[model samples]
Structures are given as C-alpha cells and as structure tokens.
Target: MALKLYNTLTRRKEEFRPVNPPQVKFYVCGPTVYDYIHLGNARVFIVFDVIRRYLQHRGYRVMLVQNYTDIDDKMIQRAAEQGFTVPELAERFIDAYEADVRALKVKPADIQPRATGHIPQIIALIGRLVEKRAAYPSGGDVYFDTAGYENYGALSHQKREELLAGARVDPGEKKRNPLDFVLWKQKKPGEPAWDSPWGAGRPGWHIECSAMAMHYLSETIDLHAGGADLIFPHHENEIAQSTAATGSPFARYWLHAGYLNIDDAKMSKSLGNVLTVRELVKEHHPLDLRFLILSAHYRSPLNFNSELVEASRSGRQRLQEMVDNLNRALPGAGAASAAAESRLQAALEQARFRFTEAMDDDFNTAGAVAVLFELGRDCNIYLKEGYPYQRGLLEKAIGFYREANKILDILEMENPGELEHDIREAIARREKARCRKDWTEADRIRDALLARGVILEDTPYGTRWKKKA
Candidate 1:
C-alpha cells in the first residue's frame, strides 16, 4: 500500500505522494526558543521524529526542515528579563531543547533554520506578498491583509468571520481586517532588530516559518507538522501568507500531535503543574517516558502521572529481561520445532502489518506500540518454550524479534562486547561492595545504577542489566 497521510488542510486521508517522488520535503514548526521546552513541545517533536524515522525506514530520502522562531515576543521578553543578548539567550535555550529532545531520541532535522539567520529569505517573501497585493507596509511595519487571501481560514477549517469574532487583531495596529496577522513588526527599543525595506524590524512569528520553509524546501512541502494547538491561528496564518505569496499549495499534509496533560490538568504555571524533562528524568527513565508517550495515539490527549510512568517502566522491563534470557541462549537457536517457525512467521507478519497499518492511519503510535508488545510476547514464548536449545531456532526468534522492533523504530540492542564489558564492570563494583561488608555502600552502588535507569537482576550464575533510557 502507498504511504497515506491525513491532511488537515483537506480533512481527509490521502495517499502520500511527494511532489518529487521518493523524496519527502518535510517541515515541522520548531520551538520559539525562549524557554525550556515542556511536554507539549516534546510530544510534537517526538511525533514528527518517529514519522521521519519511519519514512527513512521505508526508504524515502527525507529532507526535513524544522525552524527556530528565535526573534519573537517571547524571546524579546525573556532577553529583557534575563539581562542577556537575544542571540545568547536563544542559543542557550536551543541547546537545552536539543539535549532534551535527543534524550527522547528525536533526530535532528536536515535543515534547522533560525529566523534571525534567514533575514534575506524572510525579506524576499514579505516583498513578494507586498507585490502580490496580499500584504502591505504600514507605519514601518508590514501586515498580511487577511481579507486579500480568499482562503484565509482554510487550514483551520474556520471562516474568517468566525475567527475574527472571538480573536482580536493587534489593538494598536492599523488592520484592514481583524483576521489579518502581522508579517513584520517594527522594532521596539531593547528588542532584536533587522534592517528591512519597511524599517528596522524583525520577521513576525507566522511569516518566519512560511519564509524559512519555502527557502529550505523551495516549494510546497510534502508534510507540515506541529502541535494540535497550532491548528488554529498559527498554522492558519502560515497557509494564508505562503499561499498568497507563492500561489501554490503550502503543504500537502499537516499532522499535529495532541496535547499532553499532567495529573488531570494542563501543564501550565497558571494551573500550578509542570513537568520538566530534567526533573522527570531524575526520577523516571527516559525510555519509560517515551514508552508512556507511545502508549497513546499521537492525535489523542495523554494524561501523564507517576503511576503511568511506572507501568511503562515495568512493561519495558519485561521485554528487557526476555531479551537478556534470549541472548544467553543464542548459540543454540537452531533446534526449533516446526511450530516455532510457523508461530514466529505469523506473529511477525501480524505485528509488521499492524504497525504499518497504524502508521498509514494517521500515524497511530499507540496502536503500533500495542503490536510491538504482541511481538515481544510471541518472541519470548517461542524462544523460551517453542524451541529446543538449537542455534538456528534461537537466531530465528531473535531475528523475528529484531525485525518487529525495527518497524517500531525501537533500538533493541547494542554491541554484545560493549554490553558485556559494562555489565561486568557494574557487577564487579557491586560485588566488591558486598564483599567489604559495606552494606550501605553496596546499596549505594545498586541505587546509583538505578538512578542511571539501569535496572538490575542478580541471578545465581551472574547479573543482567538494562538501561532504562
């Protein structure tokens, strides 16, 4: 089956055919880079990251672009409060964002353009919009005339009049229509400014992405993604600006990950509940956090709690223990019953079919992960009970297990030598502490391993360990 995506613009699932076949030009709206990225941002990033990985796994050459809105109201305000240059503050937060998302295993985009760095491209886009009469300069600032774009509210599936009903245009600005959004903002004192044709100002939030995405992709992209919160106003404005200027489809597919709530409430300071990756990682394994996320569909709201994270950790642990057991018996994988081969094949095909099918159905990550658990159960059962101590059968089960995991983009194992060395050193240290009769020290070492998210098991013969992250 062809790769299919649910396009928010059309509100339907369509076969994903890249403008240039076999090459996906994907753009995801990146963070504004003013503060530490929260779970909402993490969910958006992970959703796209998995899509990118799956696309690569399916053999598509993906040119991914995610932009940094480095010069926005949030960044300016943060700069003033922190007493740092906008660039410096933006860089700091960008680094933190990268580290956090990398921990979540989000791959870096092929082209990560910062708004400030692409001043020329943004200027060119603004100029084009002006020439097209969709945008106009006013009092040293430029605004896109929302009324000029006939399809202003198309992406959000809202009418222009309906959007203007509850939303206010900038109070101090001259707007022909309430639905119009700013393209360029005149520089305010103490804010980062750039010399443009209109005046010394920075690219507005909506225009920055439209400009950057066009610059990187050169035309309408195959996929555009962000959080569901961006479905309105933000993404809507992007469509208005891009389509008006270029007279081309802005993006063929728009995928938005749903919100992540914490403890029955949104993760907001006003609500008095917030979970930071640094804070959460200190207590829970990063993979457990990832597992928790994968348990829910990308388009569904996820309620995060300590209990859910613990459950995810336990689920992951069961797989890891089975992996350890299977690895120890790899030399004897061949001696399997015919039933084992049939069982492995059926389970593998079912899981593979389900994972790909879920991906086709609006990238249903939750459903995909459910299939992964089924594969795990089958692999563990076949390896433990369905097969004799034979090399070929053990290897076949491992192959089937690894194949299933690959489809889900989960890294199953690393170098055996590397894993063995780490396990040996960790156990040796653990044993030395025990021998010295330093009960506290031994417990400390064990807890230290736990703190690193390496769950431990002591067998009569030896120790087996798994890194939770």
Candidate 2:
C-alpha cells in the first residue's frame, strides 16, 4: 500500500505524492531559541523525526530543513534580561535544543537555517511582496496587506470577515487592517537591528520562516509541518506572504501534530506544570519519553503525567527484553528443523505486513506499537516449545524488531558478545539454576545482578539480562 498522510490543509488523509519522484522536500518550524525546549516542543520534534525516518526507510531521498527564529521579540527580551546580546542567547538555547533532541535520538535536520543568517533572503522576499503590492510600507515598517490576497484565510479555514471581527490592532502598530501582519519591523532602542529595505530592523517572526524555507527548499515544497498551535497566524501568514509573492503553492501538504497536555491541562509556565526534556531525562530514559509521545496518534492530544511516563518506561523495557531474549537464544543453540524454520519466517513476514499497514494509514504509530507487542508474544510462544533454537528464526525476528525500531526508537539492543565475561557468566549460571529448579540460587543471582545495574527477565525459553537505562 502507498503511504498516506493527513493534510491539515484539506483535513483528510491523502496518498503522499512527491512533486519530484523519489525526492521529498520536508520543512518543519523549529524553535524560537529563547529558552530550553519544553515537552510540547519536544513532541513535535520527535513526531517529525519519526516521519522523516519512515520516509527515508521507504526509499525516498528526504531533505529536511528546520529553521531557528533567532531574532524575535522573545529572544531580544530574554537577552536583555540575561545581559547578553540576542545572538548569544539564541546560541545558548539552540545548543540546548539540539542536546535535548539528540538524547531522544532525533536526527539533525539536513539544513538548520537561523533567521539571522538569512537576512538578505528575508529582505529580498519582502521586497518582492512590496513590489507586487501584496505588502505596503508604513512609518518605516512593512506589513502584509491581508486584504490584497484573495486566499489570505484559506489555509486556516477562516473567512476574512470572521478573522477581522476578532482581530484588533496592537498598540504602536501602523497598518491598514488589524488582520494584516508585519513583514518588517522598524528598529527600536535596545534591540537587534539589521540593514534592510524597510529600515535597520530585523525580520518579523512569520516572514523569517517563509524566507528560509524558500531559500533552502523551493517556492512549492512537498511537506510543511509543525505543532497544531501554529496553524493560525504563524502558518497562515506564511501561506499568504509566500504564495502571494511567488504565485505558487507554499507547501503541497500541511501536517500538524496535536497538542501535548500535562495532567489534562495545557502546558504553561503560569500553571507551573511545564516539563522540559532536560529535566525529564534526568529521571527516566529518553526512549521512554519517545515511546510515550508515540503512544498516541500524532493528530490526537497526548496526556502526560508521572504515571504515564512510568508506564511508558515499562512498555519500552518490555520490547527491549524481547530483543535481548532473541539475541541470547541464538547463541550456542542448535538449528530448528526446516518446517519449524519456515513457520518462523512466515510469522516474521506477517508482523512486518501489519506494521507497514498501520504506518501507511496516516502514520498511525500507536497501531504500529500494538503490532510489536503481538510479535513479542509470538516469539515467546515459539521459544517455550523446548525445541532447539533456530539461529535464522531469531535473527529474522531481530531484523524485524530493528526495522520497526528505526521509526519507533523504543529498543536499545547491544551485542551480547561485547558484554563483560563475568556478567555473561552470571547470566549463564542463573539460566542453569532455573533449569535445575534451584529457585533460591536463581533468585539470589538475579538480585545480585540487579544491584549491579543489570536487569534480568525470565521468559519460558530462558533468562535474558540487560543494563538498566
């Protein structure tokens, strides 16, 4: 089956088709870089990382571009509070954001463009809007004329009249309509400034993304994604300015990950319930958080609590234990009969089929996870039959686990041969005790191993050990 993705623009699942076959251009809105990324931000990052990985896994040459809004109002205010320049504050948080996502095993974007680095491109794009009369200059600032564009509110599915009724001009603004957004801002005292056609002021928040995305990708890209919160003025303005300027579609497909909640409440500093990836990783494994994020469909809200995270950690460990069992079973065990081996291969093929089917339906990661659990159960049933292990069966199962893990990222299977000899001997001794029904010795050895950061699980086939994450 062809891969299908949910498009926010159309509000339906559409078969994913690239404008240029075998090459996909993907762009996601990156962090503003004023503070450490919170859990909500981390969710969008992880969701898109999985999407990118799956696209590449399906033989698409994906080139992803995620940009940093390095010179926004938040960056300026936080820099002033910290007695540093805007660039310095942005650099600090950029590094923090990268470190946090890296711990979650997210791949870096092929092009990570910063707003400050693309001043010329931003200015050039704004100039085109002004030349086409889609934007106008007023009092040293340039604002996009929302009235000039016929499809200004098309992306967000809001009518022009409805938007205008709810909109109000902010204080110290100079624009004809309240719905019109600023493309360029006049320089102010104690703020970062750059030489531009409008004045020596920086680009506005929304315009920076348009310029950087167009500069790296093209006028019309294949995929554009972000959190659901950005579907409004941020992405809306991007569509208005980009399409109005270039006379082409801004992005062919629009994808948005749903909001992530903390204990059934919106994550916010005012609520004092906001969680950061850095703080969460201090207590739980990064893969645990990734698993929890993937437990829900990307378009559905995910509720996060301490209990939920603990449950996710246990779930991740369950998958990890299966991989360890298969790894340990393969070594020093005789091959299975040809008929038994054929059954194992068939089971593996069935699991792979179900997994792909789940993913093809709009990247349903939660459904894909259910398939993993079924595969784990099948492995246990085969292992408990007391027949000699088939190396090919175990290897094929491991291959399936690793393939799905490339997108899910729930398992961390290290080579057992690389383990220390003493640890290996302890595991072997514990297995022997269990076979001989020496319960006391087996329990004692398990406790000793647990104290040394090695967790042991006894499956019907045998016992497997892994270090605690």
Candidate 3:
C-alpha cells in the first residue's frame, strides 16, 4: 500500500506524493535554544525522526532540515538572566538539545540550520515581501500585512473573524491590523542586531522558519511538520508570508504531531510539572521514553507518567529478550522440517504485511508497534525446545527485527557475545539444579541473578534471561 500522511493543511489524509519523486524535502521546526528540551519537544523530534526514517525505508531519499532558533526574545532574556551572552546561551542549549535527542536515538537531521546563521536569507525574503507589498515598515520595524494575504486563515482553518476575536495589538506596535505579525523587530538596547533594509534588528520568530526552510529546500517543499501548537499563528504566518512572497505553496503537506501531556495535565511552568528530557533520562531509560511516545498514534495526545514509562520499559525488555533468545539459539540450531519452516515463513510474511499496512495508514506507529509485539510472541512460541530450529529461518527472523528497528529504533541489538558470561554460567548452573530437582539451589540462583538486575524466565524451550528494566 502507498503511504498516506494526514495533512494538517487540508485536515485529511492524502497519498504522499513528493514534489520530486524519490527526493523528499522534509522540514520540521526545531526548538528555541534557550533552555533544556522538555518531553513535549522530544515528542516532536522523535515523531519526525521516525517519519523521516520510514520515508527513507519506503525508498525516498529524504533531505530533512530542522532549524534552531538561536536569536529570539527568549534567548535574549535567558542570557540576561543567566549573565551570559545570547550566543553563549544558544551554544549551551543547542548542545543540550543534541545530547538529549541523541540519547533518545533520533537520527541527526541532514541540515540543522540556525536562524542566526541565515540572516542574509531572512533579509532577502523579507525584501521580497516588502517588494510585493505583503509587508510594511513601522517605527523602524517590519510587519507582515495580514490583510493583504487573502488566504490568511486557510492553513489553520480559522475564519478571519474567529482569529480577530482573540487578536489584539501589543503595546507600542504600529500596524494596520491587529493580526499583523512582526517580520523584523527593531533592535533594542543590548539586544542582538542584524543589518537589514528595515534597519538594525533581528528576524521575528515566525519569519526565521520561512526564510530558512525556503533557502535550504526550495520555494515549495514536500512536507513541513511540528507540534500541534504551531498550527496557529506560527505556521499560519509562515504560509501567508511565504506564499505571498513567492506566489507558490509553501509546503505541499503539513503534518503536526499531537501534544504530549504530563500525567493528564498540560505541562506548564505555573503548575511546576514540566518534565525535561535531561531530567527524565536521569531516572528512566531514554529508549523507554521513545517507546512510550510511539505507543500512541502520532497525532493523538499522549499522557506520560511513571506507570506508563515502566510499562514501556518492560515491553522493550520483552523484545530484547526475544532477540537475545534467537541469537543464543542460532549457534546450536538443528535442521527444521519443511512444515515448520513453511509455518514460520508464513508468520513472518504476515507480520511484514501488517507492519507495512500500519505504517502506511498515516504512520500509525501504535499499530506498527502492536505488530512488533505479535512478531515477538510468534518467535517465542516457535523457539520452544520441542520444535526443530532452522538456522537460516532464525536468521531471517533476526533480520526482520533489525529492519523494524531501523524505523522504530526501540530494540537494543546486542549479539550473543555481548551477553555477560557470568550470567550465562549462572543460568547454566540453575538449569542443572532444576534437572536434578534441587529446588532450593534453583531458587537461590534465581534470587542471586535477580539481585544483579538479571531477570530469568523459564520458557518451554529452556531458560531465558534479560536485564531488569
């Protein structure tokens, strides 16, 4: 089945047809580098990373670009509060963002453009908008003329009157309409400044993305994605200014990942419940967090709590144990009957079909993950001691898991050699005790292994072990 992605622009799922076949220009909005990234931010990063991976898996060469907003009001304020320069603050948090996402196993973007690094591109785009009269200058600042953009509310699907109900002019702003957004802010004392036709100032928050995406990709890119929060003023402004300037669509498809909540509540500073990836990883495994995030549909709101994370940890360990069992059994596997091979092959094919079907339906990762669990269960059932093991068929199962991991990135692919020798010896001794009906000795060995964070499970095949989650 062809991949179908839900387009936020049209509020419907559509077949994914890139502007240029086999070459997808994908752009995701990155974080404002003023503080540590929270779980909500991590969700956007991970969700897009998987989407990019799946696109490549489907034979598209995706050039993914995620930009860093290094010079924004938040960065300036944070730098002042911390007694550091804006550049210093940006450097610190950009490093933090990278480290946090890397721990979650997200692949690095092909292009990580910083807004400050592309000042010229930003100025050039603003110049085009001014030339087209889509924007106007006021008090040494430049603002996009929202009134001039006929399709202002198209992307967000809000009527002009509905938007106006919540819009208000900020103090000291000079624009024709309340909805007019700043394109360039006049430089304030002690703030970072760049030279532009409007004067010495920095690019506004929304314009930075429009400038960087168009400059790095093209006038019209295949996809643009971010958190659902950005669907409004942020992404809406992008569409208005970009399309008005170029007379072309800004992005062919818009995808927004759902909001991530903390324990059924919105993450908020007032509530003091905001959980950063940096802090969360100190206690929970990063991969477990990734697993929990993927357990839900990408566009569905996800609730994060300790209980859910623990469940994900246990689930992840089950998959790892299945892989380990296959690896350990592969070395001593005997030939299988034709019937056995055929049965396993059919199961594997069914798993492949189901997994692809899930992913194709708007990247339903939760459904895809269910397919993984099903495959794991099938593997465990087939690995029973009474069943003959075919080395080639077992290897094929391992390959399927590795292939899935390329997209999900949830499993730890440790080889048999990586399993601790002492643990294996202990399991061996426990099995011997079991064979001799030495219940006390077996219990003692099991307790000892459990103390060391090694969990042993007695399967129909034999003894299987995995590290405690």
Best by TM-score: 3
- Cα lDDT tens digits, model 1, 1-469, are 7777778888787888888878899999999998888877887888788888778877899999999888888888888899988999999999998899878877899989999999999999999999989998988889899877888778888887888888875677667777777898898886778898899998888988898889889668889999998998899999888988888888888988889999879889888688878678788777778778877888889999999889988887777667656777675345545554467667777876887887777677787777767877877776556545556555655665565455444444442323556756876888887778888987787887788677676654455566554
Q: Estimate the TM-score of every prediction.
A: 0.87, 0.94, 0.95
TM-score, cand. 1 vs. native: 0.87
Ranking by lDDT: 3, 2, 1
Please say which candidate is ahead in lDDT: 2 or 3: 3
Q: Any runs in candidate 1 off by more than 4 Å, and if so which? A: 169-171, 332-342, 400-412, 415-469
* Clash count list over all predictions: 12, 0, 0
Candidate 2 or 1, higher lDDT: 2
lDDT of 3 by residue, 120-226 (tens): 99999999999899999999899999998889999899998899999976876688899999999999999999988988999999998999999889999999999
What would you estimate as the lDDT of candidate 1? 0.80
lDDT of each: 0.80, 0.89, 0.92
Q: Of models 1 and 3, which has the larger lDDT?
A: 3
Weakest 10 consecutive residues of candidate 3 by summed lDDT: 335-344
